[model samples]
Target: MSAPSSVPLVVHVIDQLGIGGLEVVLVNLINNTPTDRYRHAIICLRGATDFKNRITVPGVSIHTLGRRPGKDFSVFRRMWSVLRKLRPAIVHSHNLPTIDMCVPAKLAGVRRLVHSEHGWDISEERGSSRKYNMMRKVLSPLVDRYVPVSKDIETWLRTGVGLPASKVLHIYNGVDTDFFHPAEGNLIPLPAPGFDLANRVVFGTVGRMQTVKDQVNLAKAFVELSRLRPDLMERARLAMIGDGDLKAECESVIAAAGLTDKTWLPGARNDVAELLRGLNVYVLPSISEGISISILEAMSCGLPVAATRVGGNPELVLEGETGLLMPSRDPVALAEALATYMDQPELMQKHGAAGRQRIEQSFSVTSMVNGYLGQYDQLLGRQHP
Candidate 1:
């Protein structure tokens, strides 16, 4: 079922609606955005996960094009057909995976085209590849606007991609404070059957277990923390939630360190909010990021954060304020940061409280939805009332 043609449709194109930070933002936007304002739909170039059920809106559908890896020109033709049929007022693509969809969207007559850059440029780590930049420049005319989730990404668009300032804007990803609120924590029986984080200064992270996210390094850091200060390890526990290709590798590292009993690596989970509540400190070890929604959600749940100083992380995490920052891919540095929290419970609580306050002041779901909807309004030639 679809919304009546009387309502404007906004079609979002992405790689897949799997369990990731980018997907979390998309779900939040769709669930919070009022249906009366504009109808929404998703076109997964690959396929979606059960996470799609998290969407609460009506008349929204997730269509998969079964994209073949390496090269699949058919995806554009399929996208073209879908957009022509949907007749969306706006065609919004997410990150590099879906940016090329704008061409099909334009050919299908979508008047408004949006592309949100949820991570660093794919041209390279430094985003200095001339070929990829040229490709992006050639496609710039097709995109009406680019939404970067962090100021860092916005800068990249302006400087690295040579995009005009007028066409680029930064919008911070928001958290559901009401849903991710602090709780007494149920780590004893929540995360697993026999696992218990009771009385332990739990440091946890909730994201895909992949190379980019680099959860293995977090495991190594936890091991390093234990080796450096056995007393802190006795009072600390590590929980790595979510599952991906690197999950087995992380488990292997934990097993090799002989600390499997002290850590909980539960694969994919639906009780993320509850798990976050159980944590005293949240850690993000990604090599790169864009205002991590996990950090925002953890902060909303009154948990201090220890994140890699990369991308929009620095923007959201004020060093010595809401959280601590460390160099990415360095387990030793990450370990030192975690030790500070484990040794000082008072610091964790203070920083956690400050983090929650920050969310209330700047990163509420209302503000994020409004920021995006304002862009949609501008592209549609309407005023933001």
Candidate 2:
């Protein structure tokens, strides 16, 4: 497709290019947006990572501020200069760390400002903290529109931060159903050797190996299930795809339970959609989420999910239909849910098919892209109408 004659450039400002849900969405937006109507750019507050390789668009430019560890005012100063130079029509910032970008974007005379809250940080200011809520309250006016990816985040912005409910726009994260869809006629390959996919029931999950994702609990749950039904050790396997600080801890738990052979920890992977198609069942054991894109990817690949009942998971998983919901940090409950899927293959297939249907209907990449484009048009009309 050729570029538009007068495209509006939208610059996405992110803290870092880490492998996470927010980063994945930003990449998708850039790659999938119509070149005819929108020109996109990315500005990373911290220096960019290999994640930059994922953007395939030819003209999309990526800039970084190269800020150090501590709080630095100079980073914002540099960001202001970049905004002035680029002169983008929209400056869109993601999550908390880069929320400060709005200050610079505003000062640099950018007319439209957007901020998206992906998920809460796990530090002392974890989602429930009053101090963080107050900070959001103060920053609300700086953002022309507050885009929260889930209903839970909208509630937090309204009640927790005291932001006007009207100012919050709920936009669920979209998955590339075309990219993540189940392959036809053996098109997608299986997992690597020793990670057998022949007769075993594979339970897979993909996310950062971080505290809120709770990979440790997922490992313990797999162990407990094995203890309860030793035969499942031969019939069921776990596939965790991603690397983080908790990898060693999750590995130690599997080793202690003699599940080193059954569990496959294949660090960061690029072929996530293909990986989702190989699984019999998918799980997201996150303590918090803002409409998990991985969950949507699994659904698009026709896999039944078993995720924690937190954040926007419930909005995606239809309990008994798309997948089961278990409480966070409860290994026994997770195991029991897994056992149900293992024991009843028909139910698993039924739910998996339902999930795939849901994605085709509601969560397709086209729908997600259109939603954002519609929002942008609406914002533009408001400005120029």
Candidate 3:
């Protein structure tokens, strides 16, 4: 459906359209929301990447501010001008980078303001910094509601960041179970040339290779698996999707360990569902997280998971059930977890099956879209039909 100006417009503000969990959540929310009920627009604070093409719903416009580096005060002026032209009914911003613009949104006569903390900034602690919390407190009056993607973040905003308790609402990021189901007998070939998963247990993950994501750690863990038990490592192969600043570093780690032939880094691909299907197990070795869309998507694809115990990872991965968790920055723990799953094929299958059931029961797209719709309806005082 195309955008209809007759309905309210929600301007989703973010730092960039990077290929990450938050971007996936934004695309899912916009595509799933009924276009007749609310028209949507995206405002990138700095710029947008090719990831913007994922927005399938038509008539949704995207604007960029061309922000300069290190305290570009003029970006605010540019954003203010954009807000004036859009005159959005609800300026829904994501994360701290877009929080400053809520003031500009309110000044430009926006009706309601909503902000969601998808995850912590690269530098910012989890709502614990005194200086940053002070800024959020000062601008709290301008925001109508604060939607955190996890209960952990909800606590940080209320008790740590000191936002109003009543205004803080928690929402879980969801996956399309129908779209990301278990693979049939026929699995697609890998994107990388001559890299086959035949007779090997392929443990993989899909995310931006950044410091916070700690994909490099996962690569190092794959090497450690070789050292701990070469027999198991011979049967194991690693495939990490997505690309970023740390991609080169991850490559170096795998190459140095002489596992380049056994590992596949396909950079970034749009067909994440197909890629997930080809994997026997999913891994999320992030240093931090907030209701990761990748984990949900992987689980929906019926892949057993091995994720780090940080941020919202614990909340998502049920220990001894759906997936196993390791402490962040510890490659040994991750390597051990991978070995355990590889040692027991039946256990891996059991976990993968349970993960799919969990996604259907608790993390379906309908639940996520409904949660946001309910919040929007109540905030705007519009009754839901």
| Top of the candidates by TM-score | 3
Best by lDDT: 3
Of the candidates numbered 2 and 3, which has the greater TM-score value? Answer: 3
Pitting candidate 1 against candidate 2, the one with the higher TM-score is 1
Clashes of each: 0, 0, 0
For model 3, the run of ten residues with the poorest summed lDDT? 186-195
Give candidate 3 misplaced runs (Cα > 4 Å). Answer: 1-3, 186-189, 192-197
Candidate 2 residue 85 Cα shift, in angstroms, is 0.4
Off by over 4 Å in 1: 1-3, 121-123, 126-128, 184-198
What shift in Å separates residue 63 of candidate 3 from its native position after superposition?
A: 0.9
lDDT of 3 by residue, 288-352 (tens): 88899999999998888999998888888899999999898999999999999999989889999
How far does residue 305 in candidate 3 sit from its true spot (Å)? 0.6
State residue 356's C-alpha deviation in candidate 3, in Å. 0.5
**Clashing residue pairs in candidate 3 (N, C-alpha, C atoms within 3 angstroms):** none
At residue 157, what lDDT does model 2 achieve?
84
Q: Show the colliding residue pairs in model 2.
A: none
Please rank every candidate by TM-score, starting with the best: 3, 1, 2
